[model samples]
Target: MLVSTRLGAARQIADEAALALRPEHPEYFSAIPPPDPKALRSDVGGDLSQLFLLLALVCLFIGAVGIANTTLVSVMERTAEIELGRALGARGLHITVQFLAESTLLGLLGGLVGTSLGMVGVVVVCAVQKWTPVLATRAEFVAASSPCRNW
Candidate 1:
């Protein structure tokens, strides 16, 4: 596999460097060669991943706030209906459970719809560009596939 090959090369390089460093002129022979151009790229990838995580967290927080606001508004608008239900024997806990279930369903539906839309967009872009989709070329995939790239 590509991973084993990369790891083997890295190990060979490290062993050579170790030998080189033990020579009389240690300064001339560094412990390791300069950073690999390909390997150095992963630092940028790590930064991008961190940025994506931060953005995703922010979006999730905003979505939660929006959902909370909507729930509050719904509760206010249906106060009379809720009161009628309560009078008909529905307890406060039952009402709370009903609202939570409704919210959960709404969230699930929205997620499914969004995911479908995203996939469609990706397909459209690839079609327009006449390019094959590389669904598994993400940073994690590449890192796992190439051992020498591991930090």
Candidate 2:
């Protein structure tokens, strides 16, 4: 369980030591084993990260499509209101801006709720583990300004 920045040099040194000791004690020499110098770091973490990244991307795509579909349906359902606004001098650009603003508002609200919940979860886990909560500057600020303690 030696941690080395240079595995090649470390393994070679261990092997040389083992070989040196082998002639005097052939019976115990078999116990000395050297790890493969060419063996790479395990890919399990990288594989898991890539898997989660792909999953998040897929979920994001689906969420975006859902948002778009819901907004489209809302606009369609409110066609009469839109037409009324137009008759009352609301320009086409105004209508477009309205929907854009609505979508942006929805996104912001989602961000706020999601972040809050995530922060609370982090705080809870930290508390349960008797560990300090580590957060980015923005989150630190949020926690500092809020009623939450022990973060």
Candidate 3:
């Protein structure tokens, strides 16, 4: 049987009611148990958090793969230039650093542009819907600056 009580006293009331009724109605109370709303809510929240974490991991993986592909294509297309640099007395480390620097700049640029567009999109939507924009400054800063952390 389900019984509704005040929000704050749900668990306490469930325990007290069960204790009070058990002696007079031992059979019914023995066959049924009260549900804990708090526990249920916590379990559902944990599941949703895990699901979202997995989704975020997948997205990061895809982004990394795309960046790697772009780097490989750039290297392949610039093979002649790389060979010329090597012939001009540029060491392997120099060539490597040059590519690394280029990649870092590209990542920084992409991060900044993506973050700006995303923020603008949010603001536009909020304005059209007559809703106030709410954003965490720290999160926005992290989103805009994460690419530079690789250096």
Candidate 4:
């Protein structure tokens, strides 16, 4: 609801600006009619942001399942090693902490390597396409400030 309201407000402001400029610049406004409010509303209703959000959620679930499976296998394979550690006075908490630390490090390293490879791939594709690789500074800044710790 709030998003719709804000979009409506923005549309109104743009319409007013167009009207103000119409007399001075007749060529630009001659063929452009004001956008229908209902049409605009309907168009903005199905935002791609929500789609990307859903995709992100699905990816997160898949990643979690994969990690869980990997951890389970690791635990199973290292049962004897863990038992030895326990026999040597390693507490259950200590084992849990060690596993958590290893997983965290794996995630971090994977992210870094993946990001580097992706960037190189993008650059190569752009070069092959004969397009200048332009980076949006504002977008980069927003991404840097986001809670998501992108590599």
Per-model TM against the reference: 0.64, 0.61, 0.66, 0.56
Look at candidate 1 and tell me the lDDT of residue 126. Answer: 71
Best by lDDT: 3
Q: Is candidate 1 or candidate 2 better by TM-score?
A: 1
Q: Could you give me the TM-score of model 2 versus the true structure?
A: 0.61
Ordered by lDDT, highest first, the candidates read 3, 2, 1, 4
Question: lDDT of each structure?
Answer: 0.66, 0.69, 0.72, 0.63
138: Cα error in model 4, Å: 10
What is the per-residue lDDT of model 1 for residues 17-101, given as tens digits with 9 covering 90 to 100?
6456566654555444446667778888788778877876786788788788888999999999999999999999999999999
For candidate 4, what's the RMSD? 11.5
Pick by TM-score: 2 or 4, better one = 2
Which sequence of candidate numbers ranks them by TM-score, best first? 3, 1, 2, 4
Q: After TM-score superposition, what is the CA distance of residue 43 in candidate 2 from its true location, in Å?
A: 6.6
Best by TM-score: 3
Q: Return model 1's CA RMSD, one decimal.
A: 9.2
lDDT of 1 at 96: 99
The residue-by-residue lDDT of candidate 2 on 14-78, one tens digit each, is 55554566767645644334545334334654666678778767866887787788789989999
Model 2 pairs in collision = none
For model 3, the stretches where C-alpha displacement exceeds 4 angstroms are: 6-9, 20-53, 128-130, 144-151
User: Across residues 1-151, which tens digit of lDDT does each residue of candidate 4 receive?
Assistant: 1222354466565545545667677457533335787877777755655666787678668877777777788888999999999999999999999888877776666656755665566557767776665544453222221222213
